[model samples]
Target: MKPQLLFSLLLASSLPAADAPVQIGSRRELFADSFLIESFSGTHLQLQTPRDEGVAFKFDQPWEGLFSGYATLVTLGDGRLRAYYRGKAVANKDGSEEELTCVAESADGRTWTKPELGIYEVIGTRKNNVVLMKAHTATHNFSPFRDQRPGVPEGERFKAFGGTMEGGGLTAWKSPDGLRWEKLAPEPVITKAMVPYKYMFDSQNVPFWSAAEGKYVAYYRVFEGGIRRIVRSESSDFRTWSAPVLMEYRHPSMQAPIEHLYTNQTHPYFRAPHLYVSIAARFMPGRRVLTDEQAAAIKVNPNYFKDTSDAIFMTTRPVEGTAHSGVYDRTFLEGFIRGGIGAQNWVSRTNYPALNVVPTGPHEMSVFVNQDYAQPTAHMRRYSLRTDGFASLHCSYAGGHAITKPVVFAGRELSLNFSTSAAGGVKVGFEDVDGKPVPGFGLEDCVMQIGNELDRKVAWKSGTDVSKLAGKPLRLRISMKDADVFSFQFMP
Candidate 1:
């Protein structure tokens, strides 16, 4: 269906209260405002926005030659950000040589300065003055780490570990400041643990240190049976590592012959410890629009020959001591999934729930629900909630899920409101962390009081005593009778 027509149809079905403001609670409408269904063919990388305004860092410098491989960002001790990137360029006068493992630094994340530290001694290179790493290395795709020890006498010293087929397995390097470097060990750190002969090997080191888990995680991408998969290992001293555990994130779109699956830094936004991965895919080309089916079929395969334009972003937030994991951020895959292009049934079969920490209210927050209706036309629906007596129906459709961005309501008491299609007869109520209804609240029998016909805005207030939930963390669950909901938001 046409975008405008589909939107109009959905809006027309909304609760028609001329003066009431529309409330958003479902995942569909929560993201409806600024959501852009990205395809695989886009040039932007994942997690590039939200964290740092939507500006993509330019790794390619005309003076530095083209083909600058993937980059890993790390924060230094003094709070400076350092980027370790793979440098691929012609090396010799005969055009028979290549350079690798080039390092650069930036005080702020935007502008980069490549210094001539003389790590590598080249015979005849006088164009842009490219001084490569002395130690012969090819691909440099790892996060940099600072080796700070009590007796070590720190003065801007760091180390980086990554994989290289040129040396058989993974390798490690040391740097006094991050500019100059030397190989720590002669051999690879962890190599060919349980794999057959020597199928494929690549590693992407994560930068964040997990104090809760007490172990640092390193995510690696491996190719087996022509399928791409992600595996993780833990390290305490960055020297020895645990055996690789297969990650739940596996899709045909993320496979790569040269680079491995890499993730962003860990932060509080994850609720728990999380990792963001940069995936490579070939989504639809240009800004041209397409039907939902046409958009869904768009495939994103890894193209090694092409520049860094095909990379996409995905996330993995571990369920914290659970075997099953969840994909926290997947807006990037929406277009491909909806378009019915590559891996049509992949996400559904693979999509698992993460350990989500629901926001409690001495304050208020939003909850979003996602419903997929096959009949009529494929679309999604939404709902909104607030702490005050404020509530309303947001939007509805056939084939999308709901997600809520965590919001904080200011007051001690909060109100929740909801609405649903009369045909669906929505059930509205709250549940505790264990998926059970709150005490004294009858969820099964509580019929949501319908407010209007066109917009379907219904509201109910539950005064949650936040005296106990003040500083502690908790989750809120909202249920509807049979109607699919997008989300509910909590306001002060």
Candidate 2:
């Protein structure tokens, strides 16, 4: 059997039966299927091909001189979808230079356009060209890095976390508009604590903003030769970060070089409260020598061996509601390699049985994956849920309270009916899973306001008012002095 097939089998054998009942609250029901093994058809997901396609702004020439390295997708303030990619232009046939930090944008996720003003530029000759972005005021040195995960917002700007070359230290950047970015002082937010270890760096830094804790949580890969591990950190105000905590999971063998990984945002899947996705890449030993023509095209280091293993592998996990503090109930998918030369030899032979855990409540989640390659490919997937048996509520509280039963929704629209028992004194609003009220993103904050009146039902639904929730996972909160929620349901 193919490695991919065997991997699936192993995963399947380890999982509970599909019909098994999962407990949520005092009720028991089959866990909703978060991932659809087959191609999904809807506004949320498109281009379900098996090929390894990188994220980029839609362009007229879809495949022309596109930078396909580690990439991140962000929805800008102007309602434009932007892709910040490790831009490397295709070199000329004569082995000339062409590579830089690139940026692209799309009104819709499907169509993309490269902006004239690229984010960062690399200068010098083809062989000696170096990255020309501002140095981290913290480190005061130039570094090679990629895979940037940007946070929602703080004040009027956004925060991003990524890794640097050599020591692989964690770095931070701030952007007012997601396009024009500025480096922050006191770089390397998190690093090895004065340890004797030689190799210490952060790979695939993904941040989750928590309004409940009023802090930021980051997950990344910690590399130790022959061993790739997952680590996490917490920060407040994006300045100082907590030390790294090693996760229990690791690859079976260290034969392959693991690069990076990511976690998918929490969203409703099937009918579950929260679904999380993650992807990672492991580069097996033995490299492929490229020809002069191919070498000139990509303009990569001639000495570096080409990646010969699978371009991507991913797994999914269901947050067991509020009962569990961390990840539980996991599932693995041995992704099929499509497109790119390195994908030819990739195979999955392990069997991953389905893993199921009882539902606890809605929890913060993220998705990470490696996207560095000769052709530099990346993968993204979308999931949806039905909003039945879910309700949205608005509340006013100085402390955090866990909604034992999170409101579930179908597609991405959240509709709720609420009322306040007081006069026109205070305004009621809704917040996301992080607790921050999203303005314009409707799901962030209350797009519609409710007047204070005892037993009054106010009907509200999210659409263009809160565009961010258009196709993303979300939660609701009410910040009114005397607000009470009566009913809530999501629409397809």
Candidate 2, position 57, lDDT: 27
Report residue 300 deviation for candidate 2 (angstroms).
Answer: 8.3
Candidate 1 positional error at 337, Å: 14
Number of the top lDDT candidate: 1
- Mind giving the per-residue lDDT tens digits that candidate 2 earns over 85-134? 44334522211133233455566444455555533333422322122233
Q: Which regions of candidate 1 are displaced past 4 Å? A: 1-63, 91-97, 116-134, 138-143, 146-157, 202-208, 250-309, 322-332, 335-467, 470-492
> What tens digits encode model 1's per-residue C-alpha lDDT throughout 376-492?
111111111222211122333231222222221233333333334664444334344344554444355344543322223323344344333332222333333333333233332
* Stretches > 4 Å off in candidate 2: 1-68, 88-100, 118-132, 136-156, 165-168, 194-198, 210-214, 250-274, 287-306, 311-330, 336-372, 375-492
- Please report the candidate that would top TM-score against the real structure: 1
- Candidate 1, TM-score vs. the true structure? 0.49
